[model samples]
Target: MKADLKQIQSPIKSEMAEFELRFKDLMKSRVKLLDHIMNYIVRRKGKQMRPMFVFLSAGVCGDINDSTYRGAALIELLHTATLVHDDVVDDANYRRGFFSVNALWKNKIAVLVGDFLLSRGLLLSIDNDDFHLLKIVSNAVKEMAEGELLQIAKARKLDITEEVYYKIIRQKTASLMASCCSVGASSTASSPEIIEKMREFGEKVGMAFQIKDDLFDYGEEEIGKPVGIDIKEKKMTLPLIFALQKADWLEKRKIIHLIRNKSENKKAVNEVISFVKQSGGLEYAKEVMNRFYDEAMTILQDFPDSEYKESLSSLVTYSIQRKK
Candidate 1:
């Protein structure tokens, strides 16, 4: 049976609860308008996956302490800032079924809000003298920006190779998770080697997490996003990239033409999905995702058995196996 998030969070339930209160306090602002917007953002938060990674990794490495909570909050504040900015850049109206910050407040205010959140995160670390944790997360934020720019540059041409895909996802999705684990370990005063190991483990889990997200574009039984959204947006995911690789020149050109020109048409989108499915793209992607999942599990085996270790292991499984 698949373990749900509630069960996986059992080891760190109290820490997570305390982190929530601390996080809310960190987000508080003296400005009334900013305070109101921050509250709105807090109310619409999704599942607290990043913080779980932080707290769990800290527990595995050593004891969870004040620094661990600060580390988790730092990740959340920085990540939320990115999401707010992303909505503005994408001109998206909704995020996770709620109105985006930009949608309600408009672009100008939204941009400032993102900046505010970023500063708050920085100050939170600086005030606590958690420079080590700060360094880990700040590098991740930089990599994330670089990764987004790389994806945008590549998306225009739609010629991303498998290796390029790995690079993009590693920086775009995996880097933040890597920082979360590293920060967790660092907050516990773990040695440099152990921190690096947790970072690698987090990176592998993140890679698997992203591939699983890409698979949902093929219309899995339970999907969080609408099917064919990636194709419509002309984003070349692993399955589509692999399928195109297997096709003859003429067939490849035809699908590319369809995606470039007629993606708005439901029929064209369906054709592309059908092509990927028939070409064994889904199976290949699943195989790759499972490989990363296994690698992450192997890394987890380095740590001793404990509730924290078990929950961390379960969290890795839940990430790739989640229906969403």
Candidate 2:
């Protein structure tokens, strides 16, 4: 599941280059801890998908200005901050094939670094003086926190409804993506109507991204994490939710028993996995994700044709189809 940056279509490659440099520059502060954290994240190497959107939206709308760099860096900082906090919350050992911040350092350090990054994001956005951008991003942060809490509440509740699962994903994952697109459009002075359309595109694509991620928990061959990570963690994701809905009473009871037992070993988890496969939920979830991806592409078509539009479509395609 490697994403090739060269494959991304570019109408304004020169501007994007400048935007990338500016983003890197913005991330480069003199503080030792902050510098180290930023360097680690940069070396880990994300797709920079949100930053791409920022630059692309600005270019598609018109020119690359200071707002473009501010928006791009702010989104990157927000995303990196979230990743650090998520690693601590998940107690994760690995991320992007490297040790997570929480794995290398203590949780307290990771939390502090995450806080710094998030505060930096807010400050940079405020410096830009776009009250609307600040409001949108602030709301996204709040929603993400609420979503985490909702997932925590639903944990181990085998009866967690698909609607609740969707709500969690919408708040935790889609909201940030929505903010990314909205900020991109707003940074370029795009009309409110245009920003709304872009936000819709990001939200739909983000939902597809999250659903596909859930699907991978069952499909990924490598088992560094548990085979059924979400299940073991007592988190009910879409595939399991769908399986419970469509399963017969007997099968449903078996799932409920396994979930309730809480001490189910490798063999028991494997059996549950087989049950989910037999119930056709995995394929159903994949189909649903594909449908969302297709719909997102349809929305991209509504925007006038451009290389940025093409990359945005390609990004959604890659996100849903990716294995990791």
Candidate 3:
């Protein structure tokens, strides 16, 4: 059965509800403009997946407490900071179907807001002496920055290997999720070993989640981001990489040329999509995604059965199976 987020969050429903209130308090600012911007951000929040990961992992590892809430807020604040800055970097106007911080407030205001959020996250951790959670999330923030730079550098050359691709997504996407789980476990005073285990489990789920996102570029469904958006942006993903590896010299050159020179053209984008599909790229990518999913499930199996465990399992499933 397909897992809906509401059902998957049942175990931590109350905690998540409480989290929303605390998160708002944590983001409150004395400045009128900053307070207004923060309110806009709060109202347009997404599904709260990261906080759910934090609370659920805390539940599974130990007891949820004040520390757990702080940890969740820390992750959300830092993650939101990144997203706000990312909008400026991407010159993107929308996020989750709403006007982005930059779009509403301009790049200068958005940049300052991002910095504000980052500082808030840091202060929140330092004030509570939650250095362990701070370290975990800080490392993730570093990895994410490096990953974005690495992808940008590689995209220029169009020379990313399968190995490089994995490194990119692992650092970019998996690191944050890994930190979320580790923070959750650490907040409960779990042993380092268990915290490490949960981190690894989260990484595996993140790997699967990103691959599923890459697959969406091939028009897997009519929802999600538009098909070929990645290709149009000259961002090479798993399926495209796999197809290129299997192509003969001339075909490889031709496709690369199209991706580099004519990616914005609809016909060229369609052609690239056709080439990847014919190369069986989508099937190959799905196989790898499922492998990561299985690995995550195996890691989850190490913990005894509990409602938290079950909900975490469902959350993993929902990530890969989500329509958008």
Candidate 4:
């Protein structure tokens, strides 16, 4: 069953509200044009799941403080900047079912805004002497860029293995989540051992989260895009990768031809989805996601019981079961 986001967040509702204010204040700009764009971004913000992770992690480990708010600000700042740049790179007009920054402001302005946001995030850390926090976020940014480039490099051939797919998502998606947990622990002055454990826990949950998102490509629900958009984009997701591994040479070639040569074809996309479903690829992916979820839960078990700990567990459930 899917976990309710509102319920999962109830534990930190007040802290999240404070974090929202801090996030907005951090994005404030002297230039009117930049301020307008920042306002738009704030209005259209999604769940703010990253900040929620930070606050919850802090609450579980120690207590929320000024440092916790700063950590949340840094994560959201970098995360938003990346999304804007990603829209320009992917030529995507929509994000979270709304117009992307690139679509509304043009690529030049969008790119500049992204750069400004990134610089602000870095400066926020440096100015406050949060060098340790800077190191964690800087590494996540580096990993995300490498992960994206790797995926694009392999897109032409559509030749990603299960191991390679894990590596890509770890860098592209899990790195940020890991940062959230690490930053949260650090903000509360948790020991190095505890911080490492939280980081690993966040990484595992993030891995499961991405796989769950991949599963939605084959789901019947109408998410922001048409079904099998990943197929249309020739992206190699877990189910398709597993299906290919199980197919004979001739069948494998046929499937690859559809993905590589006829991905735009509605019939081909439907056929590929059907093939993956029939091959038990979806089931296999779900099992993998569950394994990660369970591992994350085990890590949390080492922490003492508290309302915050239960909420963090609920977050793990929410990550895998979220429809969007």
Model 1: which residue pairs collide? none
For candidate 2, give the lDDT of residue 7: 70
Least accurate 10 contiguous residues by lDDT in model 3: 217-226
Candidate 4 local lDDT, 151-261, one digit each (tens): 998898889999999999999999999999989988999999999999999999889988888888997456635689999998999999999999999999999999999
TM-score of each: 0.99, 0.91, 0.99, 0.97
Task: Decide which is better by lDDT, 1 or 2.
Answer: 1
Better of 1 and 2 by TM-score: 1
Clashes of each: 0, 0, 0, 0
Candidate order by decreasing lDDT: 3, 1, 4, 2
Could you say which candidate leads in lDDT?
3
Alpha-carbon lDDT, every model:
0.95, 0.78, 0.95, 0.91
| Candidate with better TM-score, 2 vs 3 | 3
- Tens digits of per-residue lDDT for model 2, 49-98: 77776666665555567776777777778878888999998899889879
Worst 10 residues of 2 by lDDT: 219-228
